[model samples]
Target: MKRDPPPPPPQPFFFFWGPPTPRGRGGGGGGGEKKKNFFCFFFFFFFFFFFFIWKRRGPPPFFFFGARTRTPPSPPPAPAS
Candidate 1:
């Protein structure tokens, strides 16, 4: 009885034509990079936008003062002619 030639020594599977998959070390991280760059740009734009608005508008009213001052009372209405 011949032992089926030892099952041809069990060769490992391999694909020669398929594209090589990236592994480790800066591989498959494009999405994260895009997200990071987008967030950075968004943060920068937001900061500058607010800063520009602030500079254009100057300091906010009542920033230091606690409450608004009262206006002087108007004089009584003059007698009707």
Candidate 2:
């Protein structure tokens, strides 16, 4: 049978389906080089985060903080009869 070229990519946005989502990837993930690139991104994010904190040489991230909960910002409506 005859065939047509695939459609152009859509603009990125929040979607629960289609490629990389519920519908499953349209085109399967890439080759070795693409996988390498993805790992590279992970490495950069990790290193940059550590470097940013190291440069501070100041107080490390405050991992612990007391509870922040308080009264609701708005009053509830009157209860129905």
Candidate 3:
């Protein structure tokens, strides 16, 4: 006897190729909200990042200890008699 054909694969939760439909309003609304939240997160992240850099008056410090230090210049040699 011939075996039965396999059942079709289940569909994915979201589809990109289909035309927009009124029935998909809920899903589309959720996507729009997610996009808005992503933008807000990045906006605040960059705002704080720049604020820290500006307060330090230079590039952000490394993960190690305090800000970098500079060595003082040597005193000029005394004039010969």
Identify the leading candidate in terms of lDDT: 3
TM-score of 1: 0.38
RMSD values, in order shown? 17.9, 14.2, 11.7
Q: How do the residues 1-81 of candidate 2 rate in per-residue lDDT, one tens digit apiece?
A: 987555445424422223452223323331334545666898999888877887887435443352333446798889999
Poorly placed runs, candidate 2 (over 4 Å) = 1-30, 58-81
My TM-score estimates for the predictions, one after another, are 0.38, 0.34, 0.36
Report lDDT (CA) for all predictions. Answer: 0.50, 0.52, 0.54
Which should have the higher TM-score, number 1 or number 2?
Answer: 1
Which whole-number lDDT from 0 to 100 does residue 6 have in model 2?
51
- Cα lDDT tens digits, model 3, 1-81, are 997555333333433322333333123322434545666899999999988987888655663455565568999999999
**Per-residue lDDT of model 1, residues 1-81, tens digit only:** 654332222212322222222321122312334545666898999889878877999655665584545668999999999
- List the pairs of residues colliding in candidate 1: none
Of 2 and 3, the candidate ranking higher by TM-score: 3
Residue pairs clashing in model 2 are none
Worst 10 residues of 1 by lDDT: 10-19
RMSD of 3: 11.7
Candidate 2 versus the native: TM-score? 0.34
